[model samples]
Target chain A: MGKILGGDNMKIVMVEPINISMMKIEEYRQQLEAEGHQLIAYSSRAENDQEMIKRVKEADILIIANQPLSAKVINASKDLKMISVAFTGFDHIAMEACRENDILVSNSSGYANQAVAELAFGLVINLMRNIKDSDGAVRVGKTRKNLIGNELFGKNFGIIGFGSIGQKTAKIAAAFGCNILVDDHKQHKLGEELGVEYLPIDKLMQE
Target chain B: MGKILGGDNMKIVMVEPINISMMKIEEYRQQLEAEGHQLIAYSSRAENDQEMIKRVKEADILIIANQPLSAKVINASKDLKMISVAFTGFDHIAMEACRENDILVSNSSGYANQAVAELAFGLVINLMRNIKDSDGAVRVGKTRKNLIGNELFGKNFGIIGFGSIGQKTAKIAAAFGCNILVDDHKQHKLGEELGVEYLPIDKLMQE
Candidate 1:
């Protein structure tokens, strides 16, 4: 009988830590390791860049987050079969090199869409109303007497890149009585659906 | 001409500082004093109870925020007229005493509705995703492996009160893909409009 690469024969390496809320990197490590695969994970940044390249060179699957997997690093992937990104962008990976080397690259796309959207809404509200400043002033034995804040209600909120995150932000802004103006590469029906006005990128920027 | 009981002729007192956004206490003091009324303000809490009473006493009008105006203090109001509260709650003040002395009490009702609503949303996002903990862990040389967090997406979020704040919270929650179940004293059409289901207090608790 011939040996297969399904289990213990394969080596998997995770280059950096990712938000566990979006993707459970540690759990994956434990599960993959338990299944008889050799798992090596750098849960934090590598102190030495050479050590990182050395680690990934022999990997069958490379799961990474913020840490860079440069073209030079990708060139050393003699046994590297796949690169899995735990974040939105694959810019850190050398895509051309991966293609030439017949390496598959996947990403945890839109995993943090809701988180990012909610945060965007939170920040706008916080800035307009000076919530952070108010908390700071109180801590410093001063009231908002010196600070006058504005409300988010009835203001124009401009959103660029009307993707999942932008769409979610528009909805929340609508609830706060904000007039939402969005700009994106594609004209989406979501704007009209959410009572948002779509504008050209240049116009949106000017507005 | 005889001096009438205009601004300059009346004694005014401010029990505490209020948000300049809500109402400028200092500005009011200056304006009232300029208009000819005598103004006394306790920008900070009084060290002595007797001193507090003295400040509240003999004033034609008192502007306060969360400060107690006990019966003893009201009794000292030899010429007390009105109590303007810069916050929603009036229970802090001796309402019965104010009524017995024919003193009118007014509060800045619903002044912080937007601020509270915005903050409520911010906190829920932060907690659900372990944002603060993640930031802290990174600063302390650790990754999210030590902390696994959940997303607000597709979560059932129950709001106990369906007032302004609760409704606002629901609006933001809806934006985050949360199913909103609200329990309130009254049924509002806004619930149906926002696609939020109204549940009984007990049912909401169980859910």
Candidate 2:
């Protein structure tokens, strides 16, 4: 296999990586090693900065998911050329260090947009129907003392920031027979398609 | 108020009824009393046959819900001309004594069909999402360890009875993106309207 950049095998380290991927860490390691790169992965969170520093000291590539990649860890490594985060947000990463070191930063952004939307709708049901409260009651054999619930068959649901996440949430709410109202800086086809009316943010807040 | 037969006010007794009714027992009694029928509503269960006998002694009409109107209670009252059960089922009341004494039995059937159906669907989401278990976890500050849950995006749901309750559950399931299969003695328009498939009892059991 031709080496990347025609140099010695590149060292890759992933810190506190999660199992949300389709492939396991070992399989990813094997695939990267076959392509002439060394892969090191920590399946669990590092206890301290020292532990994180030790793992990424020789890494040419650093991968992280959700766990904070503090400036201390990033400054400890001069060899890192790229920081890969397996999530939509990059706020937890030390972007300043990467910029100073000429390191590239990439994230799997928009990957969980649909998932986020689905959970929002589910949580609404969870809250309205008193699901969690009733469950605790059942466990203690005191079910329904204060377990009265409200239905979501015909309810008003408001959405802000009508992006992918907001659009997905709207679809689920539509299925629930909810009258969805959206307020955003820019309008999209999602509102008309879902039969959700676009209203002024001020108007939405009042009603 | 003039009586129907120029007779004294009718004595009516309700024994240990439940709160599953659409209208509260007191509210129904107030409506009945407004129409000149005497209402004696029990707020608690009758412990023994004598207790039940004492409650319905001079009653011209009897009302019950969930509590057992034993044969002894029925035989004790020769004045009863009607049994006004505040629910759909009549299994708890004594049918034999009513037959012998020529007493008319009536129940408030289909009163709670919508409420029952709405709750049934709410419970499905409650169970699938582990909302209750997670709530218990959060209450004790053990949030989300071994409390992983599944979404109801696409699943197979089987309904044993396609009456109001089952059909209503199917509608909610469809909202949650489920493929519904119903098994009943007779075919129903509910399946067609909801785009659910009706399967034979044996076939449904296998699938």
Candidate 3:
């Protein structure tokens, strides 16, 4: 299997490092090695064109964080088969080059949906109620004065995007009794399902 | 039920009008009224102390958003029993007055936990990797720049509070492969159970 995949001991190279402390990459390395696939993990600051190309040329499976992969780098990589992005958005990858090279690229999605949506609502509430700022004042032993924030109940929530993250955000916001106004380029029946008012981008932005 | 809660034929009066849209409020009002509660919703901007005190004194249950309830107002109120705060945080309420008067003060908790935590992670990732600014540049039709974000595959996440919301936040952060660091005033065994490093508040805050 190792010979077939790497042509006599080829390796899977991960760019930079994963920031998780609980899961050791060594365990993954050993498992892959046992299965006849070697794992080569390196911290590559592939900032410029030359560095990007150099890093891509030396890998089989490349896992990137937020680094942009240019067309020049994608074309230079002869052995690169898979590019697993560690984020939801894939706007950083050179899609045209990947298509030409037949390189499969996948990204982590629906992972941070709940987290992002939760935070947006939290921010809105914090801003409305002055929780953080007020809390900060109290923590510093200051007498609370003129601290007032608004309630989210029956409030207007203008959702910019209606994707998985956006929808999840809308759902949570709805639970808080917020009237959602969603705007998406792709037309769908989510508005009817979620009871959200669908608006054009222009109108939504204006709102 | 209404008469028992108050006296005879008493109505639940809201203070100033909520800043939400009229259509949304009307929908909520219909739901509340369907439950057999007399809703005397007012949108008054009481200018003087006399007007504010009068407005508050008339209500049985004061459903308030961000309006300040002074000690004098609470003391003067003969009918006020419950202060149903529309948002989380009770800093606006004169807590001493409420306690002395036997007024039941309640605030919404666990409403926006998931949303807030998710945003915190997003903010961490975006700040670490510069995703939002990069996306902003791309949206304005700029060539993709070399904006790097950190991977959460293994990182130290120091959680301040270990309440329901904080615990939920930690769980979601844990899913992202973060090493949890908790600092709670309460004597809870979340650290041993969740594999989180329980640190002192001073230490955690410094980090």
Residues B140-198 of candidate 2: C-alpha lDDT, one tens digit per residue = 98967777766666777888888866876777677666788899888788788878878
| Location of the lowest summed lDDT over 10 successive residues in candidate 1 chain A | A1-10
Top lDDT hit? 2
lDDT of candidates 1 onward, in order: 0.75, 0.76, 0.71
Please report, as a value between 0 and 1, the fraction of native contacts recovered by candidate 1.
0.33
Model 1 TM-score (2 dp): 0.66
TM-score of each: 0.66, 0.72, 0.51
Every candidate's TM-score, chain A alone: 0.81, 0.72, 0.87
- Poorest 10 consecutive residues by lDDT, candidate 3 chain B: B1-10
lDDT by residue (tens digit), candidate 1, A72-185: 788887888787888887887788888877888888778777667776755555566555666668889997774666677778889988877788778778877788898887
Q: How would you order the candidates by DockQ, starting with the best?
A: 1, 2, 3
**Model 1 scores what on Cα lDDT?**
0.75
Candidate 1, after superposition: displacement of residue B189 in Å? 2.4
C-alpha RMSD for every candidate = 6.8, 5.7, 12.3
Encode model 3's per-residue lDDT on A65-180: one tens digit a residue. Answer: 77778888889988888888888999999988888888888899887775576556545655665555676688799765667555565777898889988877776666555788
Candidate 3 achieves a global lDDT of: 0.71
Q: Give the Cα error of residue A67 in candidate 1, in Å.
A: 7.8
lDDT of 3 by residue, B150-171 (tens): 4554677888878866786676
